[model samples]
Target chain A: MKYLLFLGCVIPYRISSYEISARKVLEKLSIELVEMPEFNCCGLPLDPVNHELMLTLATRNLCLAEQKGLDIMTLCPGCAGTLRKVNKALREDKKLKELVNGFMQEIDLEFRGGIVKVKHLVQVLAEDVGFKRMREAIQNPLTGLKVAEHNGCHVLRPAKYVGFDDPENPVILKKLIELTGALCLDYMYETECCGAPIIGVNDKIPLHLTGEKLRNVKAVGAQALITVCPFCHMMFDLNQPRIERVLSEKFGVPVLHYTQLLGLAMGFSPDELGLEQLRVKASKILNLN
Target chain B: MKNHDSTKPNSDGGQANDRKKEFGRTEHKIVLKASDLDPKFKYKISKIPGAERIMLCFQCGTCTADCPIAKFSETYRPRKLMRMTQLGMKDRVLSSDVIWLCAACFTCIDHCPQGVEIANVLRALRNLAAKEGLMPVVFKELVSNIRNTGYAYRIPELRLKRRAEKELPPLPKANLEDISKLFNLTHLSKTLEKEERQDA
Candidate 1:
């Protein structure tokens, strides 16, 4: 099936490998990712002030996908929640839908109800690329790798809207991690916020909180962490050094986007999955020889 | 007291006698000034959906008392910012670095007796400060970099190369035109310029 890939801001520049890995793995599952040209921020940031604006922005992007007659697939949980929220709201509220549709019409876009289905990468794999197909695709099973899952805050919270999973104790990432034949270890701070919000305001708190999480990941005897959210990956993988410096702690843990781990488990090589870009080197965890 | 010796000069090009006229200097006292918000300035707290309840804040100190980071760092105080915003002390409310200090953990917002969205307001104020160029130089530079480069997270090429020496893939760049466009669409820069012009 064809879907529009919304890379958002975090995935490409800071955590480019995530996009690469996600593409590689999804391609393996027989899914085609048509890149959207000129897609801007989903305006989730605007949700605080103008919820309508947030919906308007999301509608703009969704309408772009609707133009292509394709479904929407997002790697970022924030984008997913924002898109799903807008999609559901517009589909349900006819007046609100009319207003947003009018706004879209001004920009030459239309939001026909249910024109697109926004699916997180994890859901795509488990549902579209089912466990049976995943099993068939695995060439080199991650034999003894102990993995911990950090599902990210946006994936769960504000549950009344997103409704992705049990907001308090999410197991989707854990289930995805186990599909790779890796031992999944339970760890505290699994569902905790990685402090992505405060990164703009105060870098110290996010650094400290993420550091505590990394320490917990290590304490759980996990070889690496599997995450679905790019923001979480940016905080856990890209900003790991900053966190280490601030906390005066050492947790040389490697973080993998769920797709990257799935790609690795499915017999994809390190280079193919683009595992080289991570700040926390993956060789220590991956059998990349 | 008058100086008995005037043979040496002081650092200020005066007499050294004035610096230490006598061994006992109890008569001299250091004076400290108590500062208050600028009298002419007032901050109007813009309405944020979830944070609208922030208006009910009565300076109860509950937010300050329940804050986690507040225990260690005094830079952030939700109660104080809420009070300041309610009083229309715009400059003090928006200019203070305290607003940017929120971790956005929702602890304060969740536990607030008045259902105040302390974290959300802090986010808005910080966004305002960023738009106004009131943010710290480093943060402003980072935001500028993100605007131009499309990525907020930084990884030096040298470090990426060094890390890649272990057979890791080169760091991929995230697409950031989306963010730049968002900032532009919000007229964030224009609003900031207007505020700066007004302040000047």
Candidate 2:
């Protein structure tokens, strides 16, 4: 139950609650988490601009995990997707592995493929820590709270590489949410992109996309939006005010990391899960005045 | 015939007739020449990572139909971009802003009937565009941000202070020397350096 926790760039610096709550929940589940301080960006930002460079960067982290002889448990879906994609590419293509190793040699690290596995937090919870075990751990079931799950794009997409769940119709996140006794509301554009990818390049499009999803979630009478990835959390939680201003609509939906919800269900206080750090207040959903 | 006549007054032909009366000739014309095609463009795109399947697209338009960005945007069309790449319309594909407009959400990639990997192809086109100095200024700023710090957005002082107030562990500092070395070896730094020179 041990994993090399890969909290990619955003979670460490921007969205600390995701890491904080995930660690709290994983520790409670008896999952040992380790840190590799040398890990770099998951290479997602560079992927579109330079394919080989992105592979090399992602492989560098995989090699770090290989050195520790542990599978990676990633917090961000982008890191999960990039690392899994590179791991698959290197495993299938010996020549490409050697090519990447040639670059790694300069950095004094080598990636011997198949040494470790990369699992997203959702996979770690849904698969490694089963629902029955999680349900038994719940102390305060969120009986009537309506929450919408935003799985984000990379978590279940490019299915050949990231095979955690069905790409088109994912149920892992929903199943996990239901385990908390919360109503996982189904809404239009539930699986749509949160526009985090292009947020750096163009603000308007991503804002519009996030606004659309928020509008849909609000329309469905969900009090909160549940998220797993940090970037999606940023779009829905951190940039919520800006998104509202851009769309000229008020969506008071609170965005909570899945870990926060699980933490609350396990009887941990909102303070323990860093709930106050969120832009939108989760007080209403958590029943904490 | 009566309906056609009713629409004729509102059509371009009617406008052309008005222009002809005022200026002796029509002033606007669009022509596509066979010589505009560059046969090497597809080969060039195939060399990009994740775009090996660029030629597999059969123009099903599934990418466009499934695209969330295309739904709101009048100009952003993944299907059209795929066709342009397949037809070797190099300049059009590289120079147009639509290539940069793709959100890279991979919605089209997952839903493509032909499995074209349309989003990756758009990414390849973006890479080629950036290499050719066709990338937008804002993206270059992002590249420069990564070049300066290992992260895309700089960690603000207030966020660090807030993390402390929340009793969270401080973020570990990135090893910029290693990042810089990797950037140097990969020539990603070189790309940004070229951009700086262009600005100067």
Candidate 3:
């Protein structure tokens, strides 16, 4: 139950709350996370700019994890998706492996993909930490709280690459939400992109997409929106007010990382889970005094 | 959207005052001259991996129909782009601002009956655009950041301090020597240097 925690750039920079709560929840479940050492960006950010750069960088990270012989558990889906895609590609395609290794060899590394595995935190929770053990570990269940999920694009998408759940209708997050004893609500476009990736290019379209989701989430009377990616969390939580102002609609939806909800179910206090750091105040809906 | 002053990375255009200048540099006309069509353009794209199915796209419209960006954007149609690429409208497809709007959700990939993988083809097109040194400034900053710090963004100093305060292990320092080796071997730094000279 050990993994090298891959904290991509976003979690460390803008979304520390996710890291805080994820660490708390994983520790309670007895999943030991070793800090990944001397790794570069997972190569997603530069993918569109250059595919080779992405493949090479992602393979290099995989090699580092392979050297340690521990699977990678990432808080960010983008990191998990990129690493997994490259790992699979390099493993199956000899030519691609040689192309990536041509670059890896210069850096004194090799891409031996069969040795390591990359799993998103949700996958680790859903697959590795089975529900029966998790049910037994739950000291308190988040009964009566209403939350909906926004499983960001990368984790379940491009099904051929990182196939953990149904991409069209993701149920892993909903299942995990139910494990917390909170009522999981369904909202329109539940399995849609959060539009975080394109925010760097066209900010308005992303706001419109996120604003529409927020409007729909509010329409369904959800108390909070649960997300698994830091980028999705930013779009829904940190940018909630902005979305409201631009769309001329009010949606005070408190977005929580799925880990935070599970941490609460594990009886961890609000302060321990970094609930205070959320932009939209969640204490009232969460019934925290 | 012009009056909206924003310091965010993706606001109005990443690099200050460059959106108008960089994107859509080529003006596309509705009435196209035959010379605009590069007959071999589709072949050039299909040769690239992830875009091997570019010629197979039958314009099912499923990609644009399901694209979230296409819903809000007036111009970004993945189906139209596929047609344009196949029709050999290379310059028009390459220089269009709409191409960059895709969020790469892979919704197009999952739903396409032709196995066209529209998102991957879009990425391949974007890669070609990048080869011509036509890149957004945010990517330039990311390349520079990874080149300098081994991370995508230049993570702040205080955030590093806060990690220790919270009892988390200090953020791992990237091996710059190894990263630099990749950068040079891949010739990304050289490409970036050329881009910077053009930006200057």
Best by lDDT: 3
User: Who wins the TM-score comparison?
Assistant: 3
Across A1-289, the per-residue lDDT of candidate 1 in tens digits comes to 7787876656644666777787778878888877776565566644433344456667877877777877788888878877877888789879878877776665666789787888777777767767788788878778788889888766665565566667567776777778778888988756667777556545666677678788989998998988888888888888888888878888889998888888887778888877877888988877532
**Residue-wise lDDT of candidate 1 within B136-163, one digit each (tens)?**
4444444455456543445466656643
Per-residue lDDT of candidate 3, residues A1-289 (tens digit): 9999999999888899999999998998999999887869998988888888888888888998999999999999999999988888888999999888888888788887689889999899889998888888788888888888899899898997776889887888899899888989998987878788888777888899999998888899889999999999999999989989999989888999999998988999888999999999997777732
For every candidate, how close is chain A to the native chain A in TM-score?
0.94, 0.97, 0.98
Top DockQ: which candidate number?
Answer: 3
Q: Which lDDT values do the candidates have, in the order given?
A: 0.66, 0.80, 0.85
Q: Which scores greater on DockQ, model 2 or model 3?
A: 3
How large an RMSD does model 1 have?
10.0
lDDT of 2 by residue, A101-189 (tens): 88899888899888998988998888888988889989988888888999978889887667778867789899999998898999997
Backbone clashes in model 2, listed as residue pairs: none
TM-score of 2: 0.90
Question: Individual DockQ of the candidates?
Answer: 0.11, 0.28, 0.56
Interface RMSD, candidate 2?
6.5
Q: Which interface RMSD values do the candidates have, in the order shown?
A: 9.8, 6.5, 2.7
